[model samples]
Target: MNLHSTPPRSGAVLAALAGAQFTVMLATSIVNVALPQIRVGVGLSDGGTTWVVNAYGLAFGALLLAGGRAADLLGRRRVLMAGLGLFAVASLTAGLAGSSDVLIAARAAQGVGAAAIAPAALALAMGLFPSGAGRGRALGVWGAVSGAGGAGGVLLGGVLTQAWGWPWIFHSVAFGTVLVLAAVAALIPRASSAEGGKFDLLGTVTITVSLTCLVWGLTTARGSGWTDPGVLGALLGSTVLLGAFVVIERRRSDALVPPRLFRTGRVAAGNLLMALLGSVWIALFFFLPLYQQQVLGMGPLATGAGQLPLAAANMLGASLAPRVSRRIGDSATVIAALLTTAAGMLWLARISADGSYVGHVLGPSILIGLGLSTAFVQLTALAVGGVPPQDAGLAGGLVNTTRQVGGAIGLAALATLAGTVTTHAAVTRTPQLEAVTAGYRAAFTVSAAVLTAAALLALLLTRRSGWQRTVATAPARRSAEPRASAVS
Candidate 1:
């Protein structure tokens, strides 16, 4: 399977790496679509249910940087294989779990596995492709995997949950992981480890603890209120731990994440866009199914079907990114994407209990999907675009960190909003269903507002005279070489 020097083999490598992304994304999406069923089956309370998704996100976000550094130190191939092994086993555990605790624990483990694999996979893709146009195309395909994952997960989750059971969704991940593991063994060439560094245990601990506490507080704050002692304690604890992490990194010879990486406009902008996108991204994932099942009275299958437009549009957008970027440049493309997404979110805010899916949901789905697809492709390109080849793993890891942290924060924020709205509406209820729908609408409005801000942020960062100008002025600008040169 060693295709180290052969250019054609790069395609095989991308396939293996992309397949890894596809499998992990599928596991989450399918789970998301089946949330209503899972709630009933696992006896998850409204507030507690968020953990079904958050557990994975929190672990993945917290551990991703460490995972990336580990890949650089241990060898990408070995780390990737180990991650696959852990993911497969965790999937099995999640599928077979008889209780909520077990399932959540398993999902968290799966997230850790995903965190490990993501950096290695991206770094390997970079190794196979190099920086330039070819790398951009490869990154285009890479971006597609992410969009496709979001869309496809709903469909897959729908079909599996409806036909089989929620457990089957987890089982399917296990099966897919096994296949991907085998495929990697058969397809991708072995890569030598890049230069290594000492393990940053203190930096790793500080980040993990800091992020966990922060996300926990945020997630819990909706029900507990910001002033709750528990919430305040977690937030304060997070700040102290994170502050220590920054200091620790400054003291370390080989820090987990170099402060210099933040100096690049693309890197910083990409991270911001990712966090904003993540917040909006996970909000939809968290809310849409609830809306469909609760407000629209859609069955699992029907709810899953409802998401078809979003998924299809996302894939379409991803496929079209290369052409769009070619015409408008990445900055313009990203700005357009973010604006479209914001507009869609605003439109979606108008959805009433009586609203039709095609009339209300379809257009927003298409716009949001397109926006995310475009933004994701360019953000990824920009994030990794400037890194030295040796720091490819770090670049990949850091970008992912932005995305996952955003996701965690978004879920917490939305869940809290939803809870507050529902509780308020409950007191004013004439009919229970109407009250619930009102709450959902309220949550959607807040989500739309959040996404609108995200759009502004994306616009500001990607503006020609703002961040893009910085990218243009950088000492070592990314060469706009064609994909063939970058990949070969």
Candidate 2:
């Protein structure tokens, strides 16, 4: 069942893997448009509602490294199938949940499944296509699928929520997961077992506990003050656990994540950039629906229609990213895309209580979508670039873990800032709409600043020399590679 010995049905393999990734991302974004309905239906308070999102992000981020290591040690295909089965069951549970608590728990279960599926799928794809032109093309397609899924979710969620109900969003993902499972079973070959090594149990437990505590602390801080005893305790606990994880990893031969992975500038910069991008990207989806539906008095359907341009633009950018990278180089392309996205955020920061979607939302959505999609393609390539094949799942997991963790933490911080701003405005007797708009604007402005900083960091940290080394070594490795002959 070693995929290395199987026939190379690269097209079919890529399609199956990308489809699985699409399902996971689509589930994440699909909830955004349905949040208002879910809140109302489940009788959730504002503080309780954020948990619906945070719970998933927390579980996904915290366990991703362990999930990746599991994929490596247990065999990627076996882990992937099990993950998909779990994801399907979780989605069904979510769809049937009648209370906020039940839904949140179900979502967290889904995250556990996603943590396994994401890294294993990426590792499988990487195994299918060796580094060189083939890897570049496969990554491009992968990026496009991710962008399309994320952007398309808003529209799809709106349509389903308006026509059927919010639960259909979960139902739809469940159905898609079933389809992906079938395709994956048919197309992807079984992976060989990794070389014998003990699982890093201490490292896994500490990292997972640390991230969960950290995200919980941040999310709780929005409702309870930062100085609240619970908040302080959780944050302190997270810090201690994280320190322990680092120490355990340094001492362990079979580390959950090899410390040496971060020594490469490409890996470090790529993950950092993705973390920053995820912070803003997730926040945008969370807030925009609220702005459109609550502030502008649009329906779910209208909001979905309004976001169609973003979906289209994201696909366009993803499609163009490989060519753009070829012309400008990966680092420059990423820098340019970040700057473009920052400008879009700045424009969005101008939103007002009386603003129209056409004037205030459309243009910026397109711009931001394009920038994010372009960056996604190159970032995906950069993340797995120059990594040995055996560690592919670990690398993928690390990149994705940063993104989800960054989203969880950043959203909490921005949500708190927005709430504080709105509360102060309310105390001063500002109009409710105006106060809310002010809060949203504040978040957008801060998001812009974050993206700008990411661009600067990418510029300083991503070295051309590292890319040259990858390119030079890639062909030599490919020359010694055996060709697989699977039927597509």
Candidate 3:
């Protein structure tokens, strides 16, 4: 309520923002754990079942930037609140749905709401906190959600699906949305729309079409083939659309994604790392649940509980990352984090149907969670730290854009890998549970390899002479004046 306070009630705003983020994340995991029930309930074949997840992901990934720009045009608080409202409506629709088509449509709506909310929430945080330890700490907490909230969802979803039913996942979302909506309403400050610029309708349409086509093609290519006409056409269309987007933006005086930001080595490298690391992050969170339920024969509640350690460790790692960066520099900290995460993924690949949770799952979960949190915090800091105030929303959008897009691509690729492995294992035995376990292991191996490559890339990103300072100190300095005003 006190607008003149030096801190600008950031803690309250963050709590509200994080609540929104947590609910969305919770929905994602809860639904994933209940996928089997939904598949059967809706009579979906294997190919059709994947759309349950992809529908949301495609919509969310495609529209993220447009959402951010919407925030600047519409007012961050307004767009965020609207997003929560839409999310609540979608949750209700999803909960009450009687068919797969309805469910997928509801999920797509949920994704659209998430696309609107996520960037606005993040941009508001940056706006409220600006520079220094305050912003770093805030981003650190946000980074932990990428791990902690994910872990919690697994546990919660498992219990809901096991004890109640699959529909309970949507029910849970509805309840959480009500709470988040109220909290955001009460806690978030009024934000004035900073719009005088024109919206890039063309860019938005092209990018959305491009990403949808690309992800759709990739997801389908697993069941079909790379040479499949639909896949080839989609891929080719995406490439062309992306090229057109580039050309359009270049011609525009105020483009959706300014080419100037790419000139900053830190921004470019951070976006790349966010995308690459997102691949590993998505695979670990998505598949690990399936691995536990399908291969390890764990019940939903037990599977969810099993992931708590990793979630807790992710929060711990986020808390520690800033200090690590302060001491060793961002480059070294990122390298160390990436390597640590890769090692954890490699260990995860050692899991078998016969393996014990303590011996196989626990340690790797902790390691991967820690690694992801550390890298995510650094990447976020690097992306939004320095730049003119006017470009903050765009910068934040780009950071998240890379992440969501990366996640879609990662899921598709990992799913394909897992499917191939499952098929190979089925060759040895019928398509039984044990065969599925082998496929899960193969997917884990690929996940490990992806993380290893990400680690190497993070090393390269940070090792550039100017990149380290950009990651560590520049954003804090760049936003100092505006932050001081916003806070004061």
lDDT of 1 by residue, 1-488 (tens): 24444667777778889998887677666788777678888788886577887788778888888888888777777788899999999999988988889989998999999988898888877767655456667777887888788778887888899899889998988999999899887776555334566888888888988988987788777667889999999999999998899889998888888776766567877777788778778778767777777777778788778877887778778778767777666677777777787777777777777767787778888888887777787777778766655566778888888887887777777777767776787787646666666666666676667666766776777653255532222233354333232221
- Candidate 1 vs 2: which has more lDDT: 2
lDDT of every predicted structure (CA atoms): 0.76, 0.83, 0.79
Residue-wise lDDT of candidate 2 within 279-312, one digit each (tens)? 9888888889889988999988898888889878
Residue ranges of candidate 1 with Cα displaced over 4 Å? 1-4, 39-48, 462-488
**lDDT per residue, candidate 3, 53-99, as tens digits?**
87887788878888877777666778888999999999899888888
- The superposed Cα distance between candidate 2 and the true structure at residue 405, in angstroms, equals 0.9
Q: What is the lDDT of residue 400 in candidate 2?
A: 88
The stretch of ten residues in a row with the least summed lDDT in candidate 2 is: 479-488
**Rank list by TM-score:** 3, 2, 1
Q: Estimate each model's TM-score.
A: 0.91, 0.94, 0.94
Judged by lDDT against the true structure, how good is candidate 3? 0.79
Best by lDDT: 2
The list of candidate 2 runs beyond 4 A from truth reads 1-8, 464-488
> By TM-score, how accurate is candidate 3?
0.94
Residue pairs clashing in model 2 are 7-485, 7-486, 8-484, 8-485, 8-486
